[model samples]
Target: MAFNRTRWAALAATVVLAACGGGGGDIVPSPRVPFTSLVSFGDSLSDVGTYKVGTVAAAGGGKFTVNSASARIWTELLASDIKVPASCPAQTGLLPNVPGFTGAPVTNTPACTNYAQGSARVSNVFAPSSATLQAAPFNQVNIGLTAVPVTQQIAAHLAKTGGSFNGSELVTVMAGGNDTFMNINGVSAAAGGGAAAAGAAVAAGWPTATQQAVAAGGAAAVNAAATAAVTAMGQAGAELAGLVKTQILAKGAKYVVVVNLPDVSQTPFALAADAQTRALVNQMVTTFNSQLAAGLAGTATTVVQVDVYARGRDQTANPSRYGLSNVTTPACSTTSPANPLQGSSLACTTASTIPGDTSGFLYADSVHPTPLGHQLQNQFVKEQLAAAGWY
Candidate 1:
């Protein structure tokens, strides 16, 4: 769904007084299952140091997006709270088949617990190479640093765990955000081609009013963009559902928490775009989440879906409830005018911030969350784990 700023602002103002003390209570450990480990697989949101060790992101005096030891991400906090051993995994090698891209020429270590990578996606393993690896804008790492998609990350974990879970591991999976992002980026790459493709199909007797409107550009190709994104997300969600079923649940995983894609339409990256572009991005995220939710429905596995999307939207819509002051702009400073959140987190210390302070800002950069944002995210996931009886 598109972001309704006026409506959310009204809701925020209306609930200001009522929500003063309505925030959820502290997270309490569950007694049902004494989960001993937190095995995570996802994107940068859950990554520990895959990017730092594998890619050039950390080469230019830039820290990995999730590398705040003092203020770690939700997964790190969850690991610490649940007492899971921390490990960092890195896969540095030449992409199987990319021109002029040398390998990192490094070996693997087995001490890594968090297999998540910064540019990982749900379907990257199935594909030859990820969009992040192939796309020029993302190929900053001259020595091709491959992103271990969730699929491959699980494979990496399974290689270590031998495709078997002891039922004591608290598996955390948060993917599909990059999947949705790549699909949205696909729309931009195609430009008006979506409209052209829809018009061609209509000309070939595929009669649909939506296609007709697409030809007229009445909806600015959003209909086509949404459809494309939904199809991609549906496929990704299906693969994710299958993986969770066979690789995780069937292998004796008892407590699995999968975080849904957040309302990225409200991220600084989305806000930097025009209103229509923001709406399209929002539509892509919502469609991805909807597909993922549907794929995870009616499963007997003890899989909990954390509604991070709703939680993030609520935090932005009602910042007062979360003690947030700036939910729109990023705390990091970007020199690029086109992408304001491109500022390096390593360089965005409190001294370098636009306001010289990041007290209540929700985001650290264009997309990633700040320490406070990560804390809020951890709280949400903790509540879900408590509700699911997974300690």
Candidate 2:
């Protein structure tokens, strides 16, 4: 039989085209962008060490491992990719809370880069004014009593650089989680305690007004409160997104990555609630994410919105896909099921975690993610940044 060289060449070409057709074209090369400095603004999820000096000594919303000598959040992981130091702007002049000691206010050289703080919101409804900030005890550091809102964080960055960007910076914004929860709780409290009492509770730096309201109401009343709370949170979230555009994008920021809130109801704290209550919290999260996405539809800045809400749900639903074994349980131990968020010993290592497997758990406490979970979040950010060619 004669060897047909022409037919063999044609067959090889056909096989090559066929292989390229099956999802090979989907691999679009990332168009590289020159992005230098990295600026982040958000709450505890993105905070580096704004609360390292706070007087609180609890987990979840209270001061925990994200401060002091145990600071390892997503920002640090992301910054390491660029060989940049992940020191908090507040650490320079901030004074750490010393047990049984009182002294004059301490100041350090301004860093003006990482301005994230735990318990920070898009708008500090509780401490709305500087007068209120000075009077309240929100922070024990140099930033003062007010929880620096995402807006304030951006403002501080702008103030440091004379209110302008050089178009060579990569800005990261991950706020609205605290805003969502605070609005829901505030509205829930207002449903039963009246607006004045709810306002008073927040002013006093107490967050139990919502639980007090829930206790006073029946199932129907509670459901109604939840609905109202979701609506309130959605409104606030939309405004926060708008601020990101007006404040960051409008200020000449070229690259921006904004992360939406995840399903907080899936957290250990919300998981301890009644099924109906958990459903309401999840709904509030969805509504806020939707509103935020809608608000940032056509911004001039190269804005990339990461849907963390969906990612969290998927990780819980399919743990093994993300190499996770326990999605519903907190890595840290707790004494109270009624208040799961108030857990203890967030320091997760090979020894501290139960079953001696900290990598299996999705949560470190009632609300925050484990160190492994934080790494997963950093992976998500990396994927988005690479997709947008800003890595």
Candidate 3:
């Protein structure tokens, strides 16, 4: 979600179209069946197509709090497999499940909260006794939604007045990427000192690997963030499991799966930006996953680790292999730097220092992925969701 700029002193945080993908390939696959329902929550990654949207508009053209553009996320694609209720889309469809609720499951249940806003953090933005996206049309048939860090999401669910909200009964995650972004190195310039120097560096080809290595240094910082998140998740997960034991498993909900994050290093940002940076980021990802695995040790909740990064790289390495010769996004060049945050070296824009496509898989505007790029991610997500029983 955030990236570092080599020219600048400090790497400014910017949300990329990281709409990255990782369909649970090889490492583990899904059972290829729908859950009780399909649902999602998180930052841009799991925004379920609510990104840049105002609100879910009757499953057709509409707008919301975000920009007026109507964009449906991968979740909409799930209709091919999951069953969606007709009266429950584009708005809150949740009715109070029991006594505590006054026919209102949540305080702020909108038809579709998306739950995942751009650059959103893993915190509860819900109100007690309020309905969430569960009853909405966008994802009503697919599954339920929950943001990551797991703890906060559970807190909101547990606090609800109505019953039927238990962590153990469902998948316990919203996917992870911000964790990886936080681990990247930083660049600063005494507030405003490096602009000129940054320009000079650009004229020199800007040493992509070196800048990336610096980002790699951010691993420690990210580790600290992950540690805190993991600690909080463990405590929350245990409580959720207890609730599941009482409600779902004890009652009837089957299989509690906790998805593990993919290798963040393989994201388009890491790849286009710098090789050294990608390596460092990958290492940090490995470290964090190990820590997360340790936290999830010996639990009945199955941990599904999606290998998106490696799979993404494979797509990049031989894009043509996937029928992406003309459709794939381009990567890296002076005209279009690896990332917008990593703006072109001064000379690059002028067609002087850097020029034509340096990396074949990058986009002309290096930051966002091409349609081909989005497709690859779709493939990965489809693969993993099926393997992990997401249907």
Which 10-residue window in model 1 sums to the lowest lDDT? 12-21
TM per prediction = 0.76, 0.73, 0.50
In candidate 3 the C-alpha lDDT for residue 263 amounts to 48
What local distance difference test score does each model get? Answer: 0.58, 0.56, 0.35
| Model 2 per-residue lDDT at 218 | 49
Candidate 2 residue lDDT tens string, 1-391: 1112222221110100000000001122332565566788876666664433323322222322322345366777667664455545442212223343122233333654677655567766443211233333433122232346777778878877899877777788877666555544443444344444345335423436443554454454355456556766677679778888788888898888888888877776566556765677778778888888999999634898887877887887888888788877766544443222224322222233444566667776556666667777877777777776666
Q: Considering lDDT, where higher is better, how would the candidates rank from best to worst?
A: 1, 2, 3
Off by over 4 Å in 3: 1-34, 49-72, 85-108, 111-114, 122-151, 161-172, 185-268, 271-275, 297-303, 326-375, 385-390
Best by lDDT: 1
Query: Global CA lDDT of candidate 2, please?
Result: 0.56
Residue 15's lDDT in candidate 1: 9
* Global Cα lDDT for candidate 3: 0.35
On residues 253-341, what C-alpha lDDT tens digit does candidate 1 reach at each position? 88888877777778766675568767776676677677777777876358988887777778877988887888877676665332212
lDDT of 3 by residue, 1-391 (tens): 2334542121122222243344332333333443444434444444433211111122221111111123223444333234432111222222323333122122334443233332333332221111232343211221122223333433344444143433222332433344333323222211122332232222212244333333343454333333333443333334333433543344344544333444444443455555655565556555544554555555443444444445655655655675554323323242333222233110112222134443333222222333334445556655655565654
TM-score of 1: 0.76
